[model samples]
Target: MNLSANNLCLSVDGVDHLENVTATFQPGRLHTVIGRTMAGKTTLLRVLAGLEKADSGSLTREGTDFLNIPVWRRNTAMVYQQFINYPHLNVFHNVAFPLKRAGLPRQEIQRRVRRSLASVGLADFEKRKPSQLSGGQQQRVAIARALARGTGILLLDEPLANLDYKLREQLRDEFKTLFSDQGDTIVIYTTTEPAEAMMLGDVVLVMHEGRILQTGTPQEVYERPATITVASIINDPPMNIFAGRIVGGQVTVAGFQATHVSAHLSDLPDGAYQFGLRATDVSLASTGVEGEVTFVEISGSETFVHVAVGESPFVVQVEGIHDVALGDLVKLRLRPDRLFAFDEKGTLMQTPSYGLASVEGR
Candidate 1:
């Protein structure tokens, strides 16, 4: 099933929820939509699932118009952020509900239900009611129900948001493995967390303000963000951005200078720009600007040090534990290959030869 959304536009009460959004969802691959709350992630999903009508746009499956078909008639299944299950039914019956509605034989229904349940790690909980299972287990039951529907398209809206931290992590791995082998199923997942999108999406679509900001594989988007907004949203601890200027063929931010000038900036008149670097790319140096440590966060395997260089503050991620303390002065250096330059309008200035290597080279 190839799903395509062409110039999709939706509005309510004079407010636009989706603005000319367009994308293609290829069969057998997981596509993830990532954005902040109210960024139109849910609205886009609802529109695709035929739960909401678009004011203007075209939706098609295999070149056939899909809007003429009713939501119930479409071969699509949805799992929401909330775990929805029939409290009165046991896990087996809950998963079997969709199969029964399709008029499958008793044996076929039992077989499909068992397979779906086992896929979600809920086979042993078939006899348990929703009230008797943990939140994660109940959510798995809902997933099993969707799987039992045997739909070609699966729409998941932050399905793990309701689970606890540990459970979410565990279920992420389980869901990844479960859906990896579904070559005929087209899965669309939406999430606010960048980490979740990177982990689950074979292709990721970044959205903001009802617009499709960027689309690519997770690695492509992460390594080469198209804009400053993308750089800020796609990172875990967030990229450190500083006010900068191009001076005499060199980019200068705070007290740090670029070791080499990028050809992309050769034509631009010297002016203000934004310099960005990931925390992991900033290394402690023996000879560099002195920064006062403002905060120190030590996890078991890594340490996050927040330091203030002059008036600008930046976060540094280091491996394992470090003896750095608050108020301690440390020297920091930026890896030129890992630095990003954005214009005043937040557009990324591409320098293929300046980074570690161009995308093609890698």
Candidate 2:
């Protein structure tokens, strides 16, 4: 089933919790809704599932007006953060409950139940009660239940949030493969984690303050963020931002350009502009300007170091936890090509960035 929203909005107590939101989810692909807390992620999911009515907007599924459809007849199922199961019911009964509600025949329900359990690797635990299973297993049962009910659209609101990191990662891959194999069954999942969004989503949507900021493939969103917020959300350490200006043919970054963009240098008239540089774009060199190290965090794979360079503090990811300590003076320099310039309003500036060759031997 294909689902689309137009001018969708949901307000509560005079506040627009979800406003003017619109997007389309094609069948057989996973779409991720990402936003920070209070951004109306869950509210939007409820509206799509027909659990909550939008204040103003239209929803269509397969060319039919979905808002006109009742929740029971929508063929949409919601899996919540909490696995809601009848405590006394066994795994088989819990999964079979939705089929019974749909009035499916006993034989069909039994077949669907068994198949669903096998899909989530829970076939052997059909007779076990909910309390006897772990949290991960309980969530798998929840997913199996949705599948058994013949749900056309699956709405997951942070389904794996409460699981351990290892299990969460494992389930993420499993869920992606499951939906990939489903072939035309729509799955709308929401999460605030950037890594999860990048991993599972065929289309990633960045939302904030009740609106969709940007939607594109993971690489599209990361390589070319539509807004400053989108860039900030996609990167783990986030893009570094500093205030500077273009004055007298020089792009001053914290009062020092060292590197200049002369081709379209006159584009931005002398004024304050925010300089955005990712940690990967900046590096430490032997003969660069000396900056004091503020902090260092080693995470097995790489070492993240914060250094103060003039008025701007930059983060650099070194190979490993070296012998560097806080307050140590280190020579630091930005990789010219990786630097991104933004205007005062957080919009990216239109200009060619300097390349690594421009800074390496300069």
Candidate 3:
């Protein structure tokens, strides 16, 4: 299932919700759609699943334009954040509903329902109603229903959002394995969590303000985000952005010495550029950029030190939880290759210099 969205745009009641979004989802891989609330991530998934029509643009699967395909004929299964199971129906019946709608023989529906429920680790829970199951279990039942429908494409609209941390993690890993084992299934899922994108996505599409900011592998997006918005959305602390300028291949911060990354700087003009560096990319040293620590957040394994470097606040991820107090004097250094530069328009200037060419580009 090679899926493509060409100039996809959508609006509701004359209000623009999604704009000019384009992406290709290859077969047998998980594509995660991530963005802040109202960023059109859900709307994009709806369009792809044929639940909502694009106001403009087209959707295609393997070169066949599917813009006019009816929802039921699209062979797309959509699972929303809310699991829509019938309260009175047992788990078995809920999972069997899709196959039932297919007008399958009773025996066939029973077999498919059992198989689907078993696939989602709910084999023994067939008789339990939605009210009898945990939130995570209900979600699994919902997924099993999609599988029972035999959809070629799966659309998950924040399906894991309602679960607890442990359940969410468990389900996420399960979905990852499900995609790996289910050949030719194309999954497009939406999430607001960057960590989830990093963990589960083969390719993560970052959306903002109704437009796609970037689409690439998790590593590519994390290390070579195509725009400031892309950079900001893919990291835990997000990337630290600073206003600066390039002069003779050297980038000078407002109150720090000049330096440059290994990224190709030839295509850029010789002055005035914005710089982006991730929290993990900044190192601590007394001789580097000076700052006054304003706050610190420790997460057992790492500590995020929020510092006021000149007039701007920047966060640095250090090795372990530190005892550095607020107002402590500190020095920060940018990792050479991790520093990303952008022009005034917020486009990422550095492409990934370390990886093989993208599968899409190939």
Q: Where is model 3 poorest over a 10-residue stretch in terms of lDDT?
A: 353-362
lDDT values for all models? 0.86, 0.82, 0.82
Per residue, candidate 2 scores C-alpha lDDT tens digits across 1-362 of 66899989888899898889999988988899888878788999999898999878899977899998998889888899887888899999999997887788999999999999999999999999999999999999999998877678888998998999999999999988876776667888899888888899999999899999999999777777776787787777877778877777666675446556545445667777777777876777886766899999898778898998886788887786677799999887765445566778888665334432444423
* Candidate whose TM-score is highest: 1
Best by lDDT: 1
Question: Model 2: which ten-residue window has the lowest total lDDT?
Answer: 352-361
> TM-score: which is higher, 1 or 2?
1
Q: How many backbone clashes does candidate 1 have?
A: 0
Give candidate 1 misplaced runs (Cα > 4 Å): 262-271, 292-295, 323-329, 351-362
Candidate 3 wrong stretches, greater than 4 Å: 62-65, 248-250, 258-269, 351-362
lDDT score for candidate 3 against the true structure: 0.82
lDDT of 2 at 273: 78
Candidate 1 lDDT, tens digit per residue, 265-292?
A: 5666688988788898786767776899
TM-scores for all candidates: the values are 0.90, 0.89, 0.88
**Which tens-of-lDDT digit does each residue in 1-362 have in candidate 3?**
59988888888888889888888988889899999888998888778777788889988987788888888788889999998899999999999877877889999898889988888899999999999999999999999999888788988999999888889988888888876666788888899999998889998899898898888889878877888888888877878888876678665664664445245544667777777777876777766778899998988889999999888789989897788999999987765455578878998776434433211100
RMSD of each: 3.7, 2.9, 5.0
